[model samples]
Target: MALAQFAREYRTVRRAEGWGSLDGAYYRHLPFQDLTGRFTDIWRIRARSYHTFLHRVLAPLESLTGRPLNVVDLGAGSGWLGYRLARRGHWVAAVDLLDDVLDGLGAVRHYATPVRPLLAEFDHLPMPTGHLDLAVFNASFHYSTDYAKTLCETLRVLRKQGTLVILDSPMYRGPTSGMRMVQERQARFLAKYGFASDALPSEHFLTPARLDVLSTELGIAWRLHRPGLDWRSSLIRAIGGIRARREPAQFPVIVGTCPS
Candidate 1:
């Protein structure tokens, strides 16, 4: 029953956002998305973030461990990131609540390499203890109803020395700015779709203090790695902040590892 409601809300937002044109090929070339398509420019910025994950986190882990890491991509919409990871020879579990062929677990079939698809929630992953070397919340952690549980659950499946990553989630310096961004987003959604799209409980955006708290509570150390921002991105952010009357959010790849 809950899954049905969640699917309905997910479909409503996807249709309202006009993502019908995003097919398998579109997901295939993510980060390097279509130049003329909607949200291409946003994905342009996200490419830097993804590269940061590659250079700063994944590369180092690979060099240190000297083997293909077992990875789980949480909230793997369309399984693009997982497909990419699997193509790199790492085993990947593409997990999401949505099973829609184009934007969900079912989309894993589009890729040539093998990727395990699982329909599961963040708070209760279907993986065995100490089974994975890395767990990544691919633009998905902020949507967690309870981040503490979600993080703990993810860590549960991972070996004690395993790493966890939060990729491409809008993060702010403080709660106030994050809340303001949420208000503006909700207003836009209400105006456009006659709904706030907050039907489900979610943390929405993250803050450093929040991560610090999570770190202390969960016995993990987290580092915020900011992807390089170009001049145009800074200028746009400045203008957008003035127009929105609140500070703009930044997407940083937050990486963490627990002690053995």
Candidate 2:
């Protein structure tokens, strides 16, 4: 059943290029437009669930790390999470590939905390080494074409004992399922954009075994957390039982810590 749904989603993505091009050509021209609206509408339920989960994750971490910690929100879309962290008294650097998207966040006017917006890619962050206390990839890490290199780059920017948190992305129980997602994503990108199958951005999902290997190779301590849904998610899960049951391991928050 999970495989069937996966196949169906692959076909759906193959059939249409729903948003602007990957390079932000379409959105860059429309400075005043709310480009994130369509994306938020599509992933409305998941987004809400992630938002709740983030708050849950942050509460404890905030207490552990103390206030005014330096944070980097990698792949920050509209800078929502960054803004939230900043508002909680943390200094946040919101980084994304699309400058227009960052500009659209209106962080200066909307957020009370200092939110520094940066236009950069995952593998090539323009940040000083060992400076950040936390680096968050909220539903954004899989966009990297080279996950290993990206992780290494993340390590370079994080201070000793800093945390890397990955949330809201599909995580597989094993390699086979993870590779299946990667193949389907590649096929969809190839069909939709006429690009090489390997060229797709933000399509890879992680498996626990693979993550273990990464943690070992990078010398970082890691742990995985299964996020419990709030009432809203519980109700949605009840109505979408079959869909929810299809992949129990799909969404989880994986944390990696830089060893002191």
Per-candidate TM-score against the hidden true structure: 0.94, 0.70
Cα lDDT computed for each candidate against the true fold: 0.84, 0.65
Residue pairs in candidate 2 whose N, alpha carbon or C atoms collide under 3 angstroms: 143-202
- Using lDDT as the measure, the top candidate is 1
Instruction: Give per-residue CA lDDT, model 2, range 176-213, as digits (tens).
Output: 65665566646756676554345245447787777878
Clashes of each: 0, 1
CA RMSD of each candidate after superposition:
1.7, 7.9
Error of 2 at 96 (Å): 0.8
RMSD of 1: 1.7
Per-residue lDDT tens digits for candidate 1, residues 1-260, read 65566567778888666562345577778766753387765777878888999999999998999999899999998787888888888999999998887667777777788889999888888889999999999988988878888888988999988999999898988999899988888898788877777777788999989998998899889888999978887788788988988888889999999767
In candidate 2, residue 112 scores what lDDT? 51
lDDT of 1: 0.84
